[model samples]
Target: MTRYWPRFNRAGFEESVAPIDYLEWYIPRLEELRAHNLSFSGMQYNWNVLDLLGDTIADIAKPYMGDVDDPKEIIAAREGVNIENVLITNGATQGINIALLTAIAKIRNKSNGKITVAVESPTYAPIPQSALILADDVIRVNRYPPKDYGHWRINYEEWSAALKKSDILMITPISNPSGWFFHKDDLAWIIDQAKISNVTIIADEAYNDAYREIDDYCSIHSVAPNSISINSLTKVYAMGHIRFGWIVSDSETIAIARRIFMTFSGVMSSPAMRIGTKVLQQSSIVDEAIADYRSKNLPKLRSVFAKHGIVWNEPLSGVFGCFELPNGIHSELFADHYCKVNDLLVVPGTMFSDSMQNWVRVAWSIDPKSFELAVDALDRSLELALNQKQVNKSK
Candidate 1:
């Protein structure tokens, strides 16, 4: 038997965070704190359905009992375009997997076995992992680091060239670690390039609603009808437990994706689907949740980053904000020190990709106080790291 060292950079620090343990450890403490009028470590607000929605969850769940065949009901209810354009899945992760599998099947059918995928650098880990596991050849194009730390720029020529020889292109709006979203014009150009190259585009908009302002957000589905847009109820809704997500695309793509899903996961749990339908139907509930998060927590996050002199891009939308350390400490080591000594958890940018070594992602979804405490912990950690570097240099 041989032990396999994990090649993915962030896995070790993530393991240290013990996400499952964090949930278990935090949930009970959160519940107990609720009794004392203290906030918990998640972003969802405590508003009643009546406060956010005119309809009840039960009312929303009543109409979709038959077979889940009509994608229109889900789409229309969620205010998306049409039925031919949507495929509901277990979550965004599942939608991404399905998209990759669908892309693989399409390319393999066309190329007789050779299938290649092009991805943006500093991309979400799952994109590369899925491409490696499912596609034949993978090429990664790198995005430029932001000049001001708050703004990011992508090289169009590099991205366009990569798509030319690839069968599929994977991208995320409001990238996971950087929270840097592409401009609508830039996104449009990319979509047009894909159309010309005859490549399938997979747009992961998992943080779709996390934009700083709703009007600034644009969906790639509008730009390219053929592209698959994947979204979830996790980040904005703070409903990670719901595990609901969907892919929007053309009918042919939906049919193939559904077939792949049926053969793979059979059907999503009935209860999750029921809750998901309820959640989606209440548009006001979603809006209110986003508003509450932005109004109450975003400022705290901004102030903390300011206090530490940590440079970061203000997230256009989503629970995550990316910041660069002042002293350029290795992300993994910095994050590990924060967690081990202070019980503060953060996702290292390295988890996203090697290009993100100087940055780290902080989830704004945590309680306001927890965020402040984490910032304080980070303050101490940064000083200690700087001191250690100085000592090493002196020696």
Candidate 2:
């Protein structure tokens, strides 16, 4: 496996250091500590947007259940895929789990044997954790940027070797933390290799909406017959509370995913489905808000990182990006110090990969004013840490 499960609990279940756990621990304390949250990777929620959708609320609030638009059909129409290729779920979290399970099932059904999985390093925790739990074997593939903080890409030789022995490949089109969108040539090459290797590809496209206009081809599931793409309203549309998400793939792959989903979650949330349908129809409202925030906050984010002499990945259009922390300052330790002393929250890169212990992920999805305050806090915190490092070195 790319990483081992931290340790087994008393119940004999494995636990890992995932972003969700840290967020769950930190969120309730955010307001108490008056912390400036730079860790929120999703778009800021807007109540006014919901207020304008009064009809949508009224329709979903009907006491009795009635006929409603199918979220699957809506997604199918939008993606130009057949209805059979779509499967709705609670959110991207569930979508990923179902996709992995479905991939395992398909492999087992074909060979009636064990399967190996290849996962990219510095990936979202759940992808590797789930693979470790479900697959017969697991291996890591390098997906990293050069020392100069250039565009991130995979080690082709390593990836090719891993794919030959792998039954499934898990990837994030717009990678988390790093915010590196796969280059067109790289993506096309991966698809071809997976086809030759008979490996199923599961793409987590949660951040892809930001680049939809520029690269609609980011949804690999729509182009590769053996691949599956998962996305949700949580990250892009600020509708995470609604718990709406979907998966796209070939009919056979989707059928397997549907069964896996059904086995765990009996049915889709009725209200979420109804609300999500309308949300998709009026996504432009949320899109406008996202664009506005990016326009104002992205520049500020770049400026703050440059001011502090941090090496940032510098993504063009995503809420989050990774940056290397000052020399000798561990990300986990610095992040905790930053939060407790400076009242700022930034995600430690160790949560995603052991190699990223000196990195952190910062998001610019909040209001410009709040983002400004958060970045200022980051500046003070960085200076304090660097100064401390200098004093220690002198000793």
lDDT of all predictions, in order shown?
0.66, 0.79
lDDT of 1 by residue, 289-382 (tens): 5566567767766776676666667766656667777666876677556343554555556655556676767665655655566556655666
lDDT of 2 by residue, 1-395 (tens): 22222211112343533333434444555655556888877888674545545666665655324566666777898788899999998999888889999988877877558878888777776777677777767788867876866568887899999999999998888888788788777888899999999999999998888777665345888667698999999999888998999999999888888888889998877678777777887788878887888888888877877887877778767688888887768887787775559988887876677778788888988888998899888888888888888888999
- TM-score, candidate 2, is 0.89
Candidate number of the best TM-score: 2
**Candidate 1 TM-score over all chains jointly:** 0.79
TM-score of each: 0.79, 0.89
Residue 196 error, candidate 2, Å? 1.1
Worst 10 residues of 1 by lDDT: 1-10
CA shift of 214, model 2, Å = 3.5
